[model samples]
Target chain A: MSGDPILSVDRLMMRFGGIVAVNELSFSAERRKITALIGPNGAGKTTVFNCITGFYRPSGGAIRLSHDDGRSIQLERLNDFRISKQAKVARTFQNIRLFPGMTALENLMVAQHNALMRASGLTVLGLLGLPSWREAEKRAIDLARAWLDRVGLLDRADDAAGNLPYGDQRRLEIARAMCTEPALLCLDEPAAGLNARESGGLNELLLSIRNEQGTSILLIEHDMSVVMEISDHVVVMDYGVKIAEGTPQAVRDDPKVIAAYLGADEEEAIAVMESGT
Target chain B: MSATSARPSHAAQPSGSAFIVKKALISALVALVLFSLMIGVRTEAGPQGGLIYWTRFGDLAALVGTVFGGSIIVELLRQWWGPVDKDSIVPKPVQSAISFAGRWLAPALLVFAVLVPVIFYDQRYILDLSILVLTYVMLGWGLNVVVGLAGLLDLGYVAFYAVGAYSYALLATNFGLSFWVCLPLAGILAAFWGVLLGFPVLRLRGDYLAIVTLAFGEIIRLVIINWQSLTGGPNGVSGIPRPTMFGIPLDNSDNGLAARLGIEFSPTHRLVFLFYLILAMALLTNWVTIRLRRLPIGRAWEALREDEVACRALGINTTTTKLTAFATGAMFGGFAGAFFATRQGFISPESFTFQESALVLAIVVLGGMGSQLGVALSALAMIGGFELFRGFDQYRMLVFGIAMVLLMIWRPRGLIGHRAPTVYLERNQSISSDLVKEGHG
Candidate 1:
């Protein structure tokens, strides 16, 4: 909370044709903190994630990332890969997008593609079987193994990513994102389909990611347990407008947040309905 | 077929004896009628005047009987064996055997390829055919990089082939360069073209990408045909120099391999030398591709193939991955093309046609994409099979069609569908093709 915000969004706007998916929303995610962006379906939470990750160009606003290397990057100006590679921001899709044909270990290795490509001299040295390439490859495999161990998928390292169980695939996706060594990890929905046990594991994983790895996290999730449990800051949106933003307890008790979640206060709603009749 | 299989006939009971008999009878009846109409009756003008109907009853009966008898035997065997349950996992012993073969098969094939000309030193035709098959094998491996690993459906791979051939033809003929010098140059020129072609088609995916590439191939061929001054039009460039060993050719002259080695020169020596040259090039292509697959860029190519969006999200540049795949694949195609020009001592647009692209693609698909040994084996089967049909030219296409169909029905994943993981922590297991995407272009 004390560190300058890792991500600062100001007046973000996303328009598709005549409709505004996200409008005039502003928020900040602190360094090494878990920030949750939650709302009902189609509330543009995912849109904000996409815009911040450079998948979609924002209609208006600046997405500024304060990098660990003391460089502040405007992600809106970069392409999707440059955002990840340069700004050091990584993301995962809501629907699991693991490479179906590649084994679990390979998915992680591929995240370190830029580093390894440089080491291999862009295939020239690698093709010659040089020792430099071998060292780079060894380091890549070691990092992949470390992340695999962190996600508790080291035993299934050889199995195809697509073949892993649903929860395991989710964990693998996180492991893959982590392997990129991102300064900020954005997960669309990490616990969307997980059961209680899996979500518990994910909570523990996210906590360690913030505490041990010290990577800032921004997640779009509908799973309340995950949001309430690990999130240091909570930002709620309704119809692309920020309704409340604070600590989890403060946001939980906010009247506007309650109305957004439960759909209008009972007394006000009843009075309006009576007046209409 | 599914409708027929789904039908609940009493004949389809587990015993299936009656089912076999019914299938045989139906097949025989269909064959008998078709053959009778096609071959039984004929009309000829009589020598005296009028036309007379002539019935070749003995020939008709023999043809009908053969069809009936063959179909019945086939049906009986099919019933006895039962329909193959391809969905079931491969048997443990069979799987292990296949893995063993997968490991040793390439080296064995390499050794066999090296020794073939020596064993059949007198038979020039066999050596020629071996070289042809190896050429296709090389071309197939090239296409495998684009279509298999990168999952870019390049239907115009032949354009690079033509580029390579013409590069060598132009360089060797105009600049008086050696085969070895033009060889790498040809590859570079083709890869340059590949990237040029790749740039415009970057945004396209799936069938659209395929169509654009197909158009690109046709364009290259058309350019070669129309640019008469450079390419000699359809007449082709001739007397393209054959590759030499070091600085010497493979003839009986003072500078030839035979003269240098103090041996009597026969035509076999030249043939044998060419075979070894192609063998070395093919092995080099294989070695480079295999080595690249272990590199990060190689993995990125595969990752792009799997899911481009996810690959981009993971920080791997999709454009570069795709371009590298195209350029690498095209470079190999160029090498093969240069070899083709040297081998034939000719260059023509007819040599680089859509059919060449299709044939190379068939080799990759039939071998299973992303599988190196698969491409080699498929090249052998396809090229060797076509050569075997030299006497029965009319039926070659039909046989190829049937073979392709049967192979698809038997193994939809193509032969050797198992993909060995590039980087594995402990067990290096083969991934089943069932889990692979039917890749977008």
Candidate 2:
């Protein structure tokens, strides 16, 4: 489905003091596909996500993001906000970092800040109540409303993001990331605390985003059901190194992936995996 | 275990009169310990230039007796009313009344402000006081951009004010520039300083940012004080030009506004003009801030406050956002400073002190941070309330401190604690202050 991968990491390395958090990890996520990074706790999946999103600078390696327009960006070279601004990479936190005090609609509106900022002539024309600025603001609100409708939170647009129910907040967060119009979306543990039904809903949302919006998603998830169901490609890690990577069926059958998840012997892991499936 | 539980129940059911008496005795003892030195002692200088001291045991006893009686009555009332609900200290009706007042208060205050100069045209003191109050309101509004909206705690806001005042003073005195020309120039210069201050403190937040800004303010004042060649050092720049109505001076001259209007030339006219001038400037600051709040940049500022990391994730350039906030706040401070220079006809480094910064910050905080109406009302209350307690002289600050403590206890988020959403869909709902975060920086 791709001429070239949307994102590729080459021999990435990250170190915190003497501890190597990630070591010589390499992976590529194809455009318009859902790529899931799965690992046990502290397997450095989030570190990889952080490096890709420019939250942390890797000690050694290259993170290259290719745009649809043939613009290739070295994500590691960019700073935190610039990664999102120029590289078209948007991410949500594991701990849900929505602007808690702001309304749900405002949360989405803030995501479109860069575009509206330019349309408002850096705020001067907007201050003067110019029609152009008003038009841009109206368009932004419309986009926000559309996202809210998609997330089934149109009625709750005016409610504070913090006050939303857990499932609603999770959906709202995804909607917020979408509002940025990012080419690549990174989500950290999107279904971490969701119930079975909520996670099922999340799978549908992620699929729709891929199918309808054509936005490539790179996610770090511990929930296997979410990882296997929606992920077109799966990368499994253990102790900061990629142990297995393939389609969901192949990775699920990988003995190393099961051993890493269960921390058991290869034979036992395979037996346990077979029984669980 | 049953016997122990029964004993506890027996203690809990102690007669009300006995329980009240026990509580009153404890309160009396505590009051005696607290006021023993403060109210029970008297000290004065002897005629021979030695210190003399006396004890007011009788007065102390009377105070202790009053406290004991007060405690007993309070205990009795508590028993009659049952346990107080911690959540609802003020009744529902009272809260609704306050909200109703808050909703209509802004327009009412504006109407009252407009009428002040007209009604008190002959009262020079009230006119001067009103001008002073308006000046603080403008300053509070200016600082609100940096501190309240952006969530940056700046302790050196007076630096911008000093910059503006000196800019106007040097320009008007040296180049003979009018107030109209210097006002904008001063604001620009102060904004430049704001950006200068902003750069070094970009990585800093909360108390550290506050400290650096506080130092920046002192540095500006110290530079002005020590730079004798340009600023005249402690002597200050005197003979600053006064403001005029367009080209017409508000003076007793042939080409003055009074003569042109064919009205009697009086000093009261000038005071009235100054009042109107400051009022207009304050309103302009309010108008611009409110409009800016609905803009992308304004929302970005709030988002930055709510969560800096989240802002960066959303691709907001926090450096520029913080710098713009600082520059905007400083520009208004500069405008107010320029007005101060013109109104006084003199400029001094002493005028822009840490105390001035503290006063303006106090006004902003007391006014509930971002609310424009709250800032204006707080300015009036602080300035006018200070004058109201002028007769107390020494006890003024003591009373003010107690009042401040009471206000903090009652409304920790300052007056008008609830935040009105800048832009909302459908019905606009006010957010409780408990949900709002005071920005880290």
Docking outcome class, model 2:
medium
User: On residues B1-441, what C-alpha lDDT tens digit does candidate 1 reach at each position?
Assistant: 666566554245454667656766787688778877677888788998899887887888887678767776877776677655543334578778888998798789878888898798888788899999999989998999999899999999999999999999989998889999999999999999999999999679999999999999999999999999998989989989988887788877887888888988888877787888888888888888888888898888888888999988988888888999999999999999999999899888999889999999999999999999999999999999888877778988888889999998877878977677898989877787877765786
Worst ten in a row by lDDT for model 2 chain B? B82-91
List, residue by residue over A101-178, the lDDT tens digit for candidate 1. 899999999999988989999788888889998998898999999999999999999988888899999999999999
Candidate with maximal lDDT: 2
CA-based DockQ, model 1:
0.66
Go through the candidates in order and give each one's DockQ. 0.66, 0.60
TM-score of chain B in each prediction: 0.84, 0.88
Instruction: Output the worst ten-in-a-row residue range by lDDT, candidate 1 chain B.
Output: B82-91
Interface C-alpha RMSD after superposing true interface residues, each candidate, one decimal: 1.3, 1.6
